[model samples]
Target chain A: MDTTQRTEQQRSADRRRRELLEAADRVVLRDGPQASMNAIAAEAGITKPILYRHFGDKGGLYAALAKRHTDALLASLRAALDAPAERRERVEATLDTYLAAIEARPQVYRFLMHPSDGAPGEQGFDVGKHSAPVLRRMGEELAQVIEERLDLGPGTQQLARVWGHGLVGMMHAAGDWWLGERPCSRAELVRSLADLLWGRLAAAGDKVGGPGF
Target chain B: MDTTQRTEQQRSADRRRRELLEAADRVVLRDGPQASMNAIAAEAGITKPILYRHFGDKGGLYAALAKRHTDALLASLRAALDAPAERRERVEATLDTYLAAIEARPQVYRFLMHPSDGAPGEQGFDVGKHSAPVLRRMGEELAQVIEERLDLGPGTQQLARVWGHGLVGMMHAAGDWWLGERPCSRAELVRSLADLLWGRLAAAGDKVGGPGF
Candidate 1:
């Protein structure tokens, strides 16, 4: 085929892949990880054969979907870290960005958070592997700020781990609950969580000698 | 329908139900909630007919298993609450009991904490509803302690919710991460959690005057 035809074919395939991923997200969110490939293909407005041609199978489709979201999420986190801001401001902005991403694509969040229940050899994607470096970088940056602001001892890494996990788990639970048929606004939910987390951090700092000064 | 025969039949049925529930737990844990009735029956050393005779169907069996575990867990919580101890000590004891229960039955703990991805109307096996009242009672009791010890006004209920969810989430996450895996003993896990919580409460009280004192 000529270069023009080849490029056109590649673009068509890329669009199809993106469409399949979008449909997979819908299926997983609406029906969960147990959603069947036939259902996903139907949702994508494609034939099952075509879906198989693009993704190989349900497992490949799910993995590609996970990887796409994980990449997007990490990129957002990196952007949050790179933006110039005060320490507290950066933390808050990063959290807000994280929360917004989860809210917008709750299925992606659920896929990452829950254990994979798919067939053997179809282990659900692992965000921990993808997100660990981002977390480490965030921790390193936050630790430096913490050291400059507080008399953090050698235990800062442990503290950061605990704090990071606590915040993540807190947001996850709150987001899950909110996703249920609840009556709270996102702003209210975010504020309640931010207050609980920031309040605890502020208290920790006060107890540990008022942030280095 | 003689009394002796009737009693024997009842005993046999009870044994079958127990076996089925235990098998269901194993199936759900090893395989996700989608484990088939045929698989569960095989695991229980019974034919499909006997499994059906015992529980009617898979949903009924799953619900029965969930209800049974939920009752046992709540009973443990009640026992902890009834133990004669100071208020703070009682809370600590309750935390320990909760941790132990989760540690002992990690699979059941996971099922109860997170909703299953089963058919619609199958996710109501909520241990949280059963435990929420117990938590509310503890919160009220703790409110009295806070009233006597701290001067925080009108924030007791909200604070209790925050503290309650935090402690529960912390312990649940710890159980998920540490059960059969972590180097820390249950006692150490409980102590660290209790200390972190109570330390925060004490410091918060110091910041705002002692409530109702």
Candidate 2:
């Protein structure tokens, strides 16, 4: 094809892919991590074989959908992290940003981070394998930011990376439990987590007539 | 059967089950998370059917294996947490205990926590589903300890629960990454993580000629 025709075809193909991804997302929203290929294809008004042709398989489709959401969530987190504020305010904002996202679209968050939290069986892709990379990616991205911005002396890079993964993990585990139990309000969770980052756990006194944690 | 005979039979059955589990452990150590029923049976000097008879299925076997490792790991962690030391010392010791366990037996840790880290398709059970509950249990256990020991005042229980999960998560994620990369000595990892919990991140200064983290 001529260069202009090829360019036109590429644009159309990209648009079609985006449309397919949106359909897949809707299915995930409804069915959760157990979203099936048949359901997605039907949602998009396409046949199963055609859907496979576009995305390769369930794993491929999942990767694409995860990327779309992870990218968006990361962008919001970046904004929160980069905002001009004191360190504590920025930390709370970032925590709130993550909690708010997960709180709003828990299904998507579950799909991306805890696919196996859904009822199992009939899933063809390796759910655990896929979900972890998203966390690892977020951890790595946060590590880069920490390394670039913070003045951790001596082995700054290594310390930043460790803190990056450590912070992400703390957020994820806490958020996952919070989502399940709703034990406290989102503000409380954010405040509690920021307090943790700020070292209140160390500062707290031992309960009277008891051994300390 | 007589009561004494029945009791003897139960004790023998328990012994047999433990033997089978030990065999399974050996196979898992050799083969990582993909330790198959056939391999386990062979290791136990038995057939596949016999292995199934004991554990019900791959999922049952996996649960048993996970519980064994988790119980042992938790015991060590409890010791570290309960040791009569300063809070910082206890925290470092706890972090070190976990890291040491994972470093010494990465394969077992991977099998329990990241079964999908191994090659896929051969796994019959829901690896992700099983692995997460271990972390959840650890988090809850830690939360209880924090709530009981720390005097945070007012919403102390809820805050303790949040920190419980968050701290466990931080340890897990950092340890997981460190195990894979060996970026620093275990001591350094422990200190950095302890520093993180002690509010070093919030106390850190901005890098010269750059925005702060």
Candidate 3:
């Protein structure tokens, strides 16, 4: 094919792939992972053969969907990290970004967090694989802030890991509850979480004599 | 019925109920929630009628199992609160208790954390109902420690809530990851997590400009 034709074909394929991912998210959100491939194709305004031609099978399609979402989320988080702000403001902004992402696509969040082991042929969709790197990045960022503020030891990475896990967990639980019939606002939840984490972090430098000063 | 006969019947019922719950956990872990009622009953060496007699239905059985595990977990947390320790030690002890509980019953942890739409007849269960009170209790306990250590304003309860969520998240994630793969030693994970949280807690107080300083 000529260069222009090849480029046109690539653009067409890219658009179709994006459409499939968006459809996959919608189907999973509405009917969960059990949503049929044919249905997703239908929702994408494409035929089954085209969907199969692009993704090979249901697992491929889902993995592509997950990868797309993960990439988007990671990019957003990375951008949040670089945003100009003070330490406290940066932490809060990062958290708020995370919460909004999870809230915006809860089903995607659910799929990422909870892997169904029984599902046949579903492979390479591990949250930890994607999440761990983001987490490490976050920890490194926080560690820089912590180290600058306090005199931590060589075990700062481990310390950052703990903080990262704790923060992730708080966001996970708050997101889970927010999706339900909970009484709190998302802003309130995030503020409460920031207070909790910042409060503890601020306190870390005060007393090191094993609790009692 | 006479008191003796009634007492005998109740004792047998309670024993049978306990056996069924254990069997249910096994079946759920091995076969997911799709495990049939008859299979569970057979696994327990009891008749399906007896299973129904104890738990009205499969949903009832699942709820009861969750409640029982949650009760045990909450009780353990309560005991940790009573352990004579300093502020940081108490927080660490609470985390240890939680991690132990989740590690002991990874399947229960999965079941509890499963997503739901709050629709009736859905198999998804709510952890917040049972967990919220435990969180409140932990918060109150932590607040007591923080109050004694630092004269931060009346925001101790909120701080505790955030701490409680962070602790629960760490344990939950650790349990989820550790179920199939031994990423880190349980003791190490617990200690790392404790150090992270307690260290942060220690540092956070310095920033608050409290009166106790």
Candidate by candidate, in order, the iRMS in Å equals: 13.5, 2.5, 11.2
lDDT of 3 by residue, A92-142 (tens): 787788888877876767665443322333222333333333444444454
For each candidate, what is the lDDT?
Answer: 0.55, 0.86, 0.59
Model 3: residues with Cα > 4 Å off, grouped in runs: A1-17, A30-60, A103-152, A178-188, A200-213, B1-16, B29-38, B45-58, B102-152, B155-159, B174-187, B199-213
Model 1 ranges off by over 4 Å: A1-16, A26-34, A43-57, A70-151, A181-213, B1-16, B23-35, B43-45, B49-56, B77-96, B107-152, B155-159, B180-213
Q: Taking the tens digit of each residue's C-alpha lDDT, what string does model 1 give over A1-213?
A: 599999999999898788788888888778755566777888988768888788775546656776677678767876774566654455557667776887787666656654343333222332222222333343344434333333334544344334444344444445544554343566655554555544442232212221212
Candidate 3 or 1, higher lDDT:
3
Docking class of 2: medium
Calculate each model's fnat, 2 decimals: 0.03, 0.77, 0.17
Q: How many Å off is the CA of B171 in candidate 2?
A: 0.5
Which candidate achieves the best DockQ against the true structure? 2
Tell me the tens digit of each residue's lDDT in model 3 across B114-172.
Answer: 42222222223222333343444444454454444443455654444454454465556
Better of 1 and 2 by lDDT: 2
How far out, in Å, is residue A150 in model 1?
A: 7.1
Off by over 4 Å in 2: A42-49, A122-124, A211-213, B36-53, B120-124, B211-213
